[model samples]
Target: MDGVRFGEMQTSELVVSSRANARVKQLRAAFQGHARLSGGMVAIEGDHLLEEAWRSGMVLKTVFVSERRTVPGIVPRGVEVVRLTEEVFGSVVETQSPQGVAALMVPPVRVLADLFEGAGAALILIAAGVQDPGNLGTLVRSAEAFGANGVLTTPGTVSAWNQKALRASVGSLFRVPVVGVTASEVAELEGRGVRLIAAVGAEDSGVVAAREMDFTAVCAVMIGNEGSGLAAEWMEMCDARVTIPCPGPVESLNAAVAGSLLLYEASRQRAVSKVSGS
Candidate 1:
């Protein structure tokens, strides 16, 4: 497909064969948080993610395709496309089976207000100190699937833009409004009249069962760290604490599973309420 034509679209001037090349170095840096901050872009590997980014209207700064692959027509006009030697491309990307395409994109800028743009009795998911990128990504995907208005991450939570998180999100990251916030900022949700619900282990006594809570109210469900559970300060801020009923002997649900279940319950409650009203 090397001869594939783009009518009048412009192509990159040089083929990058060396891993030491400046552009290659820049791509490598984009994989790291600090480096991404310096470059102001994130590296998304594989053809699927690149396409997802494009479909979501993410600004593509540059596209890198491996020597063995064809440039996908999905790439927008005027975007710089760099062809890299297979060996060099492998060296620059994290995925073992590189889809022969990747792109450096400007991470979407989002504010707390964006989460509530059209929200009425909004459902928001808050990841508080959840360190696993995969878990965080799954929660983000579930957030969108279950009709969440948006997702917010606390200071200690992994950035949803992390490469592993991005991949695990299965492109939902692009579609969901995810923004980071500090502990102080989280307090603002309460001021906005949104109920803060804390999710705890099923073993925890004296907590309301997940399904028993009224999720039809404007609410944000907070999922805490995998190991330590929610911080004391966070729990204190919650309007109510809830636990998913576990019939098995397992100590607790996985963070992602727990969060997803809570979201599903919320969606169910909201749907029922709407139907009953109608």
Candidate 2:
């Protein structure tokens, strides 16, 4: 069990003892988000995320399993599987409590045009400068749950493939189209008839409340950074500024929470519009 190579391991596969092993090093780099080192593949831990990646038809490059655990049944034939010692596996993963299973997968490539392809009016969530990976991930999940056409992260927003964000998204990142674009690229959407809606704090006087806004139209809702909220640039670029009124007297809601509520409202309005038309 000690002298096994870090290549594909089966029933006869033994523990990979060397931290210097190529596969182990690759896994570490991927978890750290070194795009150059990871060959553009993203890392995901836990069986659930692994299974979700497989179910989502992600191009699984390799599955890394702890020597203490058997390779999961979800892994299809022909995909590379590497077995690592528990100690070495722990060192490579980000979680304090290593899940015994992890995998590297190629994230799906998408463009702004992809978001507008579907039949109905496009409902896109544009993350302007949201720094927190968890917040970005949650926004993607809500985007999917609320039937958004896609989620776009502009410059300064964390990457959707980030490890923490990927985990936080709970597999929705794989299903939802999360594309990265520049602020300039977003401005072009306005010309395409996609209205840009800015999410603002409740203190912004005269801004429409979430429930009252007309979200049935094609729109991109932009969530700003956690610390500074939306900058003047994005606010000015937006055709409308919408706020979520809070009776609790809080300054503002979390970025993810704000974005989720906005998406929910949009979803609700779309459903009502559909019913009315029918």
Candidate 3:
């Protein structure tokens, strides 16, 4: 199914009706973000994530289909598929209305080198300390949508695979590589000639307007938390500071919005540079 499926496929397998079933319990725990209980498998519901997971070639631990729903065509052969009763399935899924499908996929292990492997110049989005799951997810979405090479999350940021963030990203998580790093690791980027640009408030003095900033070079745009913006330490590490000029009367943009805007500006600049052979 292309979208959320409500009992769209018919399966002949027996339905798992017991909430106490071992696998069901594990699924529930996964939905609750218990990485230990779920053995580090990421739980994803809805048809869109299922399709994206398959498209991205993620390792599927199991695919749970609501009773009467058959395995989606998007699921590859030899993958374990289970059928769950409607009542039991709804209990485990975070969604008020379960799309009658869910899956547990192994989160890929990535190294710093993975982020720099592409032929194009590295354009990574850094989440310094953003706490909102949806915002983190949107940042991942924006990174991929704007042709960023990857997303790097600092120690204090929320998990990029949070349920709210996952749904908010609309399946971008499966396609993008998200790496969590420590403060010292982030500092090492500067040693590698990667310019760190701190996104600051509109009123910040000495900050370049995003459009005027050159994003063609290798750079990582850092987005801070919702309340305080970037810390002094992060700001100190940045080679430059950029602010999006908002003509309207607004104090600041949301963390995700500011990051997305910056990424879009970077993409625009990169596209121009590519076309003009600069």
RMSD of each: 3.4, 1.7, 4.7
Across residues 1-278, which tens digit of lDDT does each residue of candidate 2 receive?
24554354433345678898777888888999998898887899999999899899899988888888888999888787888888899999999898899988887889888898969899999999999999999999999999999998889999888888998999999999999998789888988899999999874666899998899999999999999998888887999989998999699999999999999999999999999999
Best-to-worst order by TM-score is: 2, 1, 3
* lDDT value, candidate 1, whole model: 0.87
Q: What is the C-alpha lDDT of each candidate?
A: 0.87, 0.89, 0.87
Q: Which stretches of candidate 1 lie over 4 Å from their true place?
A: 1-9, 36-38, 203-205
- Kindly provide the TM-score of model 1 when superposed on the true structure, using C-alpha atoms: 0.94
For all predicted structures, in order, the TM-scores are 0.94, 0.96, 0.93
Per-residue accuracy of model 3 over 64-143 as CA lDDT, tens digit each: 99875767897876666778888889889998878899988898887777889868889989999999999999999999
RMSD versus native structure for model 1: 3.4
Query: In lDDT terms, how accurate is model 2?
Result: 0.89
Residue range 66-106, candidate 1, lDDT tens digits: 88888999998788777888898999889878889988898
